[model samples]
Target: MRTTDVVRAAGGCVVRVGAAGLEVLLLHRVSPDEWRLPKGRVRPGEEPETAALREVREEAGVLAEILCPLDETEHQFTDRADSQRRTKRTIYFLMRPLSSTTAPTDPDFDQAVWLSPAEALARLTFDTERHVVGVALRLLLGQD
Candidate 1:
């Protein structure tokens, strides 16, 4: 039997009402060439909610306020650098953008774009994130 290292992380489904409808922000990683929601590991002494807002600011370069917590998702993967299996538990928040301009401060992501819920669901590389977006949509639409 093996014990898996669990990494605590957080992120946001930053959304707004646009012409096409609710739009979610998605980050395009440079190296991996994948579309994902802005997220990162929670630092020492940092709250998960704080980490989620910081990640959104750092990765998307957009200031946002949390409307509500959307979901907490866990997934297992092998870390590319360490080659060790790990489980990432990420808490996601539903956020509303405060600033319109996007100038990503994180070098890991080269592009940040707002996409409709359907588009975001199709573009997101991970199912966990897509599910988070769905949760956000439900909350915004008063369906939850």
Candidate 2:
């Protein structure tokens, strides 16, 4: 069996639930024409929660507060760049936007939008990511 290790990363699922309804922040990947939550690899010496907050700001141009525990998922696939098989263990945190206005700041993402949780889950490219959004949505809505 080929030995493979899981890489740790942190990300945020920012949800704004209020009179406007439950809307989730989604970002389009620069290279792949797919919608996803704002996230990235955890930097060395950085805590996962801090990395999650940093990623949300860096990718979505939004400051958010960690509202709940980390939602985690693991995915195995070939690395897009090197084609080496690998597994990425992504730690996703539920966050609420601190400000009313938010946008994508990372050049890696071409666009950012707030959509209903159902729509976001349907539009997400990765199944694992979709599940993460579902869990985040439930947690944010106090249904979990």
Candidate 3:
């Protein structure tokens, strides 16, 4: 049997109460041409929580603080560069935005925008990320 590499990643659902009620920050990735949550690999010796906050700041060009642990998702895919099967386990945190800027610093993504929960759910390319954001919305709205 071929072994699949396991990768640890973390991300945040940066949300705030906007005029439209609840809004979520999403990144528009250029390479895949898809909308995604701001996330990345957890660095060596770094905690998942810290990685999530860092990724949100780096990718969204805004600062945020974790309010609570949202949820985790795992999925498998083939790496394009190496043609190797890999499983990515991502930890997600519910975060509150600390800044107003929405410019994305990461070159991999060209756009960062805040959308309503329903809109974000519709715009997200992956079901896992959409689930994560859904959980965050429930918690924020005191439904969870």
Candidates' TM-scores? 0.92, 0.87, 0.93
Highest TM-score: give the candidate number. Answer: 3
Candidate 3 lDDT over 1-144, as tens digits, reads 233388889999999889968789999999979999999999989999999999998998979999999899999888777998899889999898999778899999999999988899999999999899889877877897
Between candidates 1 and 3, the one scoring higher on TM-score is 3
| Ten contiguous residues with the weakest lDDT in model 2 | 1-10
| lDDT comparing candidate 3 with the true structure | 0.90
User: What's the C-alpha lDDT at position 97 in model 1?
Assistant: 94
Go through the candidates in order and give each one's C-alpha lDDT.
Answer: 0.90, 0.84, 0.90
Residue 50 displacement (Å), model 1: 0.7
Candidate 2 residue-wise lDDT, 3-95, digit = tens: 345567899988887576999999988797889988887777888899999998988888999987657888777877788888887899988
lDDT of 1 by residue, 1-144 (tens): 234488889999999888978888999999888999999999989999999999999999999999888899999889987998898889999899999888889989999999888889999998888888888888788898
lDDT of 2 at 2: 39
How many collisions between residues are there in candidate 2? Answer: 0
Clash pairs, candidate 2, are: none
